[model samples]
Target: MSGMSSTQPWDVQRLPRADDKVFLITGGNAGIGYFVAEQLSGTGATVVLGSRNPAKAEVAMAAIRSRVSSARVRAVRLDLADLSSLRTAVESMEVDRLDAVVHNAGVALDAPPRRETGDGHELMFGTNHLGHFALTQWLMPLLSTAPAARIVTTGSFAAKSERLDLDDLHSRQGYRPKRAYGRSKLAQMYFGLELDRRLRAVDSTVASVVVHPGGALDSLTPSRPPVHARTTGAWLRMAPAALLVHGKHAGAWPAVRAVLDPSVRGGQLWGPRIFGLRGKPCREPVWSQLTDTSVAARLWDASCDLTGVDLGTIPG
Candidate 1:
């Protein structure tokens, strides 16, 4: 797989026109997902913002329309924590050919005692990894129909410090919020890379890429429509923007690049240019654990078993 180097400067302003393309972004109502939807819609792509809350989705859609008068965007109810909801959301879509699916929805924080999704798996792992795992499987047909489709899974910087424990995949033994979040991210990256390998083996045109929004802070983000309050604490909100926290708009760049950059290929990981926390989108090194083929294969098997969705049999 080819890698993006920091030496090459990528200009977000140069994104090519996406006139008739269609994209579905999970958790597009706020945070980096909202910015990603805005950026894609600005380029003329039809965007579907998937969120669990209808009200929030509507607010996000309104905001997008207000900003880009010509924006073609809509909202759909999608709960990543529930497999049934994911399937229903896909069935409800009118998409004949999906250009890309941005798996951006996830549980960012860990629960003190560890939580489980409706599917009976750890909340963070289930929502972040298993949910996306099932979603991509269900959307394979739409993706395959497109001339060239991309699957951009959002990972995190925390992945660098955490490794998956196959025996305790669900955190049955013990749990820490930060570690749980890291494990989920590591799984996401592994899945993205492994998916790329599988697609190549089947000679399919679909590309799978992993991207991380650097440290994006709500306090630093410019206020927009819908009048939503900042989620950050007042103390941090008042402090000068940290060098590592590059606000939501800048953070969305890596995912946007993974989606639209013609030069980006399957199996490549993209992140911030400055130490993975801030700066423009660029290629970055993945953790060695995430690159382990054996581990990825094992993860793929476990995901299938847990989600009860199989991508292996999908026609190429």
Candidate 2:
């Protein structure tokens, strides 16, 4: 249990080569996603941003370009809230194969009440978990082209609030905004870990890893609050430190490390080395002994059924 601080062991600057490599980052326009893209693209990787709003995507691309004069970056439309959007974006992208798919996009619905996506699934469940679930499955084949493809999905410290709520995953029974958000994040971790298990079973080149930002950075102060009040407050306390102590690169380090670090262990969690909720990058444990393996198995089947994506060819 490391605590948040200025000192940490691993840093992404040590990475050797990223030139010519291709990467796709969901929600790459802002927050840790933006930093992840910046770090990778600065190193010469061709980073494609997946954003819900095409216009915002362009703006994000421009911002990154301004920072990294020679950064290779592009933006494409990707709406996790709509299954159709995810399909359209993936089909339209021109990359033959991706070196990594950073599954970082997620949503939070606070206080007002439970909401539903265009596909009628619980907003949090659909956007945060199912949306990325489908995207990763669809792009799984393209990832195999790389020597060691990685899938870095974002989770949250809030996941500790509860286990998988299989009976009412959509929060239909008792819709609590915070609870729904937590459930979605928990699902992400379970799926990420399970995907790793599947990859090992099939000996696939792709590896699934999960990371959490611990908290938001102060730079995001103006933009971060509206995402979700409860979530914002839960993470805001760490923002000052996240910004002052870690900055953009530090905020994005968990996912960046999870994606590019060869030493990253499949199914292992990474986050701020200090309090884990906030600090620099390092390996951290998240799952409990009672995490419900059966739920993981069932959720995999349910995701395939929900997304109409075939997992038969992929590992278990």
Instruction: Give the clash total for candidate 1.
Output: 0
The residue-level lDDT of candidate 1 at 278 comes to: 81
Model 1 — TM-score against the truth?
A: 0.93
Candidate 1 per-residue C-alpha lDDT over 1-316 given as tens digits, one digit per residue, 9 for 90 to 100: 0233434556786566788899999999988899999989988899999999999999999998899899999988899899977778998887888999999998877459778898799899999999999999888999999888899999988888888998888988878888988899889989999999999899898999999987877777767656346555743765565566677888899999888877888999999888788888998877688878999999999999888898887557
- Work out the TM-score per prediction: 0.93, 0.87
Error of 2 at 41 (Å): 1.3
Tell me the lDDT of candidate 1. Answer: 0.86
Best by TM-score: 1
Residue clash pairs of candidate 1: none
Model 1: residues with Cα > 4 Å off, grouped in runs? 1-9, 227-241
Residue 249's C-alpha lDDT in candidate 1? 83
CA RMSD for every model?
3.2, 5.5
Task: Point to the candidate with the largest lDDT.
Answer: 1
